[model samples]
Target: MKKEYFRYINTLFVVIPMTLIMAFVGLMRNYGFGEDWIIKFLKAWSVMLPVAYFAAFVIIPNARKLAEKITGKS
Candidate 1:
């Protein structure tokens, strides 16, 4: 695949599972476990996934740059 297509596919694969797991753990920590908690977790995950996706793309490049600077790589 082309680079743009690969980046999007990579982002989807990574972000979906990570967001789901993190959101579940975070909500469970705050709210405790229950059927209602499951519903709330799903609702929050729905909002969080897209925000995470966009933020990852924006933040990752800058983070890589900062890391390289710190290490004096390239």
Candidate 2:
């Protein structure tokens, strides 16, 4: 519950969708999967399966720390 909680949440929304897009784009860029094929591959591979949180391994808690200092959550 810090000032940037909303920003953190926005990051999630953006990152997840962006990841899906990136995955599709990547598969196409790498393997030349067509749009329909990318859609199927994404459906097959699933979305937001922890790749986005790799950054959160650092970002979330640091953000929480700043948030805590400001909001005094602890």
Candidate 3:
């Protein structure tokens, strides 16, 4: 459990920045969102950021193991 806990922490270190980088890459094509769109996007980020945090902190690290455990896979 301790090892898994550490692994989860390590996963977040990797995931958070990677997610930010990917978001940046996506916005590269559109340097400007316009005032309204930018506000809308910022508003949406309240919901989106936590979902992303969960995925990075919880989902990604154990995803394979969880899938295998669920599917009776090795």
**Every model's Cα RMSD, please?**
1.4, 7.0, 5.3
Estimate, for each residue in 52-72, the C-alpha lDDT of model 2 and write its tens digit. Answer: 756766777799899999998
Off by over 4 Å in 2: 1-8, 34-36, 43-49, 57-74
* Deviation of model 3 at 43, angstroms: 8.9
- Assess each prediction's global lDDT (C-alpha) against the native: 0.91, 0.69, 0.63
Q: For every model in order, what is the number of clashing pairs?
A: 0, 0, 0
Q: Write the per-residue lDDT of candidate 1 for residues 1-74, one digit (tens) a residue.
A: 68869988888889999999999899988989876997899899999999999998998899999999999997
Best by TM-score: 1
Residue 16 alpha-carbon offset, candidate 1, angstroms: 1.4
Q: Evaluate residue 49 in candidate 1 and report its C-alpha lDDT on the 0 to 100 scale.
A: 94
Candidate 3 or 2, higher lDDT: 2
Off by over 4 Å in 1: none
Clashes of 3: 0
Candidate 3 residue 26 Cα shift, in angstroms, is: 1.9
lDDT of 3: 0.63
